[model samples]
Target: MKIINYREVPILRQSESPAAGKIWSAEGSISQRRHRQTRNGDIDMAVGDSLSMDEYKLTLASPAKVVPLDPNLVLPKPTPDIETAKADLKRAGYAILTDVFPEELVRTARQVLADEIKREEAIDESRVAKFFVDPDAKNRRLNRLPDRHEVFRQVLEHPVVLELTKHILGPTVLDESYLVHSVDANVTRPGSGAQFIHLDASNGVGHATPNQSRFIWCLDEFAEENGATRVVPGSHLWNPEIDPTGATTYESVPAEAPAGSLIIYTDMLLHGTGANISENRERASINFGITTPWCRPSINFPLVLDPEVMKNTSQTLRQLLGYSSVMNGGDYPWESAPESIRSLCVPAKMAY
Candidate 1:
């Protein structure tokens, strides 16, 4: 095992001077036995050893085909109560909670998304493009939602959603194990094609459980005619060996719900976007993902987030963004931390 010196972390260093944060790198491995372990019973520790990366390959699933849905399939329906929604999540691997957000809030979020998309288009038209599954170029994806606008950040902090996140991910010895994985928006325009069915959890190789969950905030009413999300109910509990490829045909039901509804699902669940067949109606949803703290988030919020937004955000939001997260037995510095945010520095006592 490789041992890292916590003091070597630049952000935790006492001095602000450039030299004080100097990083040490060596080509050869260093062992503590060379210096202090001339005496017996001293632990032989590898300090500067290079770690090797292991490759675990998978049998690639074949390309999926846009197939017709089985209308006879019965699945969980949307509910207004939290208990029922939670029950549905347990039973079907997904749940839809209606009226979770006020209609006005949904409207504001839609407007904000539109404005942000426009701004992004102006900056780089390539930023907005059709989903890979949408060959006709009807569907569009907007990435990094929280970094785009305050409305997205506000919606991402919904208490109910956070509660569900905690429920799904559970807690570690330190604190809540989950952190913000990513936030994005998916817009399915008319004639948009169906997406390939897949699992959100990349680690679902064999018996491994899901380490991630998602919150899909509806910006527009989802209907069968429009592009509602389609899911294979109870698929999360299915044996991992039963891999469904693009060529495979599986029964799926639309997770239809009204605007302002929230859809919760685990990464192990097999799901995809339904094709939009409506002439005028469009389907839009803001997708937020939360995963265990050990997982690398899609977006590096700490490195890329606007400083102004970071300065004014709430403690929960900061924690969710991984600001307070402990890595390799070290966390953010306490002494240099502002009084307003110091509570986040150490939620769990470090054993060392």
Candidate 2:
């Protein structure tokens, strides 16, 4: 089996990135092993060539089909007390918890981002668009936040966040195995434009399993006038016949929340970023993409994690990062564990 390295992933495809483990690659009837032994699947987003590239551009194309905001949908409903928010997620596809974090934490995250930007500016490549895979769409964003700072480390398993993930992400193909797809940030500039409402599932186009979920940590208050996120409350439950193209004509409501609030939504839920209309203010938020045990994260943790960081990180975080799995996402039972991950997880003695 070949071991896959996550850190040095080359720029191969914008939509399709091979998963972390043993995978199937069909190129002209020839079957080849993609990795030694992790997980397997294929997700491609660019459905068309250069001229017909219209898959990931599902943003509002018609100005008349503008998005409207509902106070209930946008307001930070507050969590731990999530019954109301839970109902909203069930009915509206998203729920927001206002002021869920301490002001200090929020400030620290922003500071971390600012420091990164300063470092990038030193190299004269700090343009927001630079972070996007598509260089054409230059906006303020970061791809791999976990790789850069530990400030985000705690959020990896924030109690409320974990509960939300377990409630939605649930069990994967494997019994109790789940994994993180990615942990990134969306730091938008004043003039940043909105994106097409989309799902966080594979980059592929089509109806996907409701296995992915996104948690947005709003570092800045999301106002109606500014770029608050847009969502179709009940769109997560929409029939596949509605729009197979992944395009959306459904009107969206804004998710207005406090700076320290958290916005959690399912992957099947239709959502997108709103344009930062504030004249001079920037919208700063960190996003965590939690996926099933079988998917590949945009930024592979095993490869990007600093040795020192890994040494000090909690077992919970380490498991989410993929070091705790024996085979392809813990396919083997706990009793039949592999020694490779013994260091990552406390193996139960032939038991649960």
Candidate 3:
């Protein structure tokens, strides 16, 4: 058996020998035999190894077992009531809740991002430059590229948000969605024009469907001068082909929510970020999506979470990422767990 450490592998205790205690190191790695003996008359064979000992006293330990420190971590306080938010969701395409997250969390997250940007900047300037400015001037709207930012993870798992999402999308709703892009002005250059008005799920495999929703969190203050997101309220009821201009007189309202405020909406809503005409300051917003089991996510979450992160994530988050099942859906498409869960389970099958 492959062992991560000596503790993981069983050891034979010297006192357990029924005959004259014969000390033979399985690998001769430990020179001290006295240290290897236990008070009980039994061999401490490493896990997966067999040893003759008092059946009652011998303990079996599996390295794979994980014990979490806190299983029921309460969610951070919410700024807006969930019922009110749900009501808004039905009335308008989106609803904004102000000051939902703790200010400290936002400040710390910003610091973490700034440090990461600085480090990445030192490594490659040109590569990081693309993260800020639009490649095509015509499509000048800043796109915040999301790739497992620490703050993003924190925001995604926040309890209040998750609870609200569950209430709106149904109890089975998971945080399958994540930040597709994070647009920041400091990184974005001037003349970054408005993005083409579009729906969040236009490219989604399940478009105009009932099982999807997006939850956008404003990490920084979003304002009219700083390229706040513009939206057409009640546009979710319209068909996809509807033109932006001729459409039911859209309103380009500034999404000026304070930091930690969240904007929850249906993916079908027509919205676009306004141009960042500001000279120095940049607007930063984190966009995350949540959906029912039947829909495909905007960003492939299972692919991004590394093994370590996956192991550390909450069961709720795992289910949200399509790592678990809801009842026995069998082998139907969208019925089974996502490919990420299949990959994680393969090693377990091999072990048996």
Candidate 4:
């Protein structure tokens, strides 16, 4: 296990000998480190003698012990593999998974989004308009997608998504596991302004570790002119004290890709929606994400999901929706009074 100095640990010199104060040159000869200290009068030596007995009083204090890094604070490095996506994630905190979604699926999903948007606008223009308003007109956002359509469920259970999600967040439920955070979509229309840069990680400043990650499934081609996502490269590894939102110094580049590509990124990486200056192009993407089982999901799926949608949903999908299994503690215990939802749960085991 890697160890790091805790906040309370004081910085101390390594040794307390005459040689410890000396700077060693590449040739193994002493430089002028000790000489500089003597000249500054920072160190004073005291000597005592009693009946021919001699003693020396040291100035430097003993070295402090290093604290083992808190497990919660430790951000696990991606396991190196033949896949370029994993390598990209380790290097830049984000990766583009090419051709993950098929052309047919993308078309169908896009149609569904268009229909949903029309229905939402018809129902309540004010509410729908407010969601689309990222301080601009024509742009919009769709929320609570799992209950709305089956294609989203298929997107949620994609083998690639499950594999990489497990790769980023550990497979085990003890420290990490995949739990659906939220399923939403963004529609950036022409003339829309850029959204503010932000971090998706909960309490990102204090708890800098990555507990969440996202998969942005593009429904349409993302281009710089049509408001593709702008990401700050290598920003995930930055210190928590550095706030990228208000700071104008950080450089963020557009993550442009084709219609079917997947933009996978850790929640800690700084990112924002780019402005759409194009004449007619409208950029659309399904923003889906998973958080560690211990973290509270952004959407309470059990409450919001329609009963009919859960009827044919897969056990894994149900589990992702906060049913079954045990980690820090099981989400919904099977031993409870309800028998209809028993199929949603698995044999539970506590993380000890």
Candidate 5:
């Protein structure tokens, strides 16, 4: 019930931050330290402590609202040919492209982020909206900007990522990309990381049809100790509910990789972020998704992007974004429905 900025949530203390060279346990909830009010009304609490504006509710003071970074400003290097990208994606839930973006672009973006941290101007304190926020604070959403920032857009439409999407989804794939979420180094703390053992679909069941896929981009290196994402291989093939006794049978493995790596997996895959035990650094990433035309998106991408942005995007990108329709039964070039019926119902286009 507390309201606060998203960036200033105080999850890790300056001294307790994780170091650069090791793995550590970030599981379990850390207790919230009490806040002391100064005469001028300023509140003081160490880092990694919860900032509750009120009891029973914690607030996250993020710097800016989440939005997509622009794709045109900084493009990733040409990905491996489609076939190679496909093979890597299939074997592992994700793929890594070292030195993907122009080294300068990556350096600049990181510099901007670092400067923001120093200025303390990037902290967003807004309460998470209902649609995106999880009922359990354990899985709360973080703020990320999606406006036409070049880096955000480039990553969203990265060729390697799209090529692989096409391999799994088909040649006619569209760009169903958007800013799924972003984490600030200062705000994310140990245990506050997403550690739930669940699929993205469990939040709300889709049409009982299978057509969605997710792509995760690591803007920074993700290691096992710094809350790198973890996935259970092949769990996407399991039934929706895996009994607790069998839960342990489904081994949880970390999706560790360097910056510029992309992890693509089906909606059925079981995954979550490992705990952030490191007291020194933050883990940041961008998550995008694409589904068949018949299925709905986990995030509303169309609503976020304008027509110009959509129009400028590649055809493959648009298809993955869910802009096109789906056609079934090999019906091509013509429709045989009666005039009256055809007028009442629009045809569905398939994403091959």
Candidate 6:
């Protein structure tokens, strides 16, 4: 595993480290991260901010051992292959699919997102479409990504991602009704502190498995310094109500990988983004979820993607984007109505 600083470990002796009785509470806001309240009461801090040797001196005092990553952070499992990837994902609640897309394609994908962000930001200075840039100016999640570029449409159905979705969710559960829950971008700007260490969903995880999973294609090389994703390995096995804060170390190992690699993880896994200490680097990634049909997706696909844009996209892309919800028994107004009747309704403001 590529660690940001092994040197922070040696700053304090085993006893001097403030490992015990340190309190962690979620205060201020969600993005600010839950701060670790040192026992002295004079000091308190959050994770995303660059840790000081003083904080390390205190944090290391906890029983959370600062050990080198074991079994590695990014799975070495070869992929575009199913069985190996499946095995790793099942075991760890996550897996890495290496070299699934070429480096150039991934580079262009990042560029496409960058352009979209710029264009969207210009339209509404306060709010950029679906993205709500955090107050810290560090992390921005670009929602409704499929609507932004045709290239993203290709990314949504990448072969390995599809296969894994099928394998994890299974044919019985899927029943040909799998849907794209959300297609978005996770851009960690320089100095963007680490994100809240939490699961995507708390239900059906740990005690039970979930139907939703994501394949986050790395659009930039993920390194410890540039805010690579952090994972607590197998925290998916904990009970549903188990608190992650004091129960486990938020001191996570960075799942460092190449730009074209995909980090596949279930919503259940305990994970968060590392702090980007770099002054001039951003960790770019595409969060594409292939999920079961039951839940209302993270974004209402049809509402966000206008018909004009859908016309130019491929049929597969169109379906994934919920254009074919009509085909999947989602037809409420009229089952077999003409296109006009299907999309339109009698005027609500009609006069006699």
Give candidate 4's TM-score. Answer: 0.71
Backbone clashes in model 2, listed as residue pairs: 2-36, 21-38, 21-39, 22-38, 58-196, 59-196, 74-256, 92-233, 129-138
Give the per-residue Cα lDDT of candidate 4 at 36.
Answer: 15
Candidate 1 structure quality by residue, lDDT tens digits, 129-164: 754434336677898676677788887677887788
> What TM-score against the true fold does each predicted structure earn?
0.72, 0.70, 0.58, 0.71, 0.54, 0.71
Candidate 4: give its CA RMSD in angstroms: 18.2
Q: Rank the candidates by lDDT, best first.
A: 1, 4, 6, 2, 3, 5
Reference-based TM-score, model 1: 0.72
Task: For residues 178-239, write the lDDT of model 5, one tens digit per residue.
Answer: 22222122223344443334455523333242344576666567776666766655444454
Best by lDDT: 1
Tens-place lDDT digits, model 6, residues 1-352: 4444211121123233366754432223332222333354211222222233233323333324332334553444436555676777877777777868877788789898888777767886434432321324547667667667767877776666667776777753214346688777888889665554456652433447765777778888888889888776665555464353322333446777777888888777766667778999989998777666555567767666655666655545544555444334443454575564235322111011
Worst 10 residues of 5 by lDDT: 1-10
Q: How close is candidate 5 to the true structure, as a TM-score?
A: 0.54
Clash counts per candidate, in order, are 2, 9, 11, 1, 63, 6
Alpha carbon lDDT at 16, candidate 3: 41
Candidate lDDT (C-alpha), each: 0.64, 0.58, 0.47, 0.63, 0.43, 0.59
Local lDDT at 274 for model 1: 73
Q: Score candidate 3 by TM-score against the native.
A: 0.58
lDDT of 4 by residue, 24-57 (tens): 1211113211111223322211111111111111
List pairs with backbone clashes in candidate 1. 63-246, 64-246
Which stretches of model 3 miss by more than 4 angstroms? 1-79, 125-150, 171-190, 202-209, 244-251, 325-352
Model 1 lDDT at residue 352: 14
Best by TM-score: 1
